[model samples]
Target: MVRVHPAPLQARLPAFSTRLLLRGVFVLELATASWGGPPVQVPIGPSAP
Candidate 1:
């Protein structure tokens, strides 16, 4: 029989990084919205597969 194991911190590192990246984007968007600047173009890095 196969047993399932919970993921460890090392395996979750990517998820943590992704969350941080999203948070950064959110903050940037909020800042731009508040500033009311002329349509600033934010370059998002390549997405993960």
Candidate 2:
């Protein structure tokens, strides 16, 4: 047996936002290193098993 599903737009939006946020963070880091700004760290999580 198996199941099929389709992710809704609302669900997809968070994923899209997360990806964009990561890109933005990278740019922020570069700017901080070259231009100077407060550092920010978004921790991911603990080690996996």
TM-score, every prediction: 0.53, 0.52
List model 1 lDDT by residue over 15-36, tens digit each: 9999999999999988888687
lDDT of 2 by residue, 1-49 (tens): 7764556877899999999999999998888876676554545567433
Which candidate number maximizes TM-score? Answer: 1
Global lDDT for candidate 2? 0.78
List candidate 1 segments past 4 Å from native: 1-7, 37-49
lDDT per model vs. reference: 0.81, 0.78
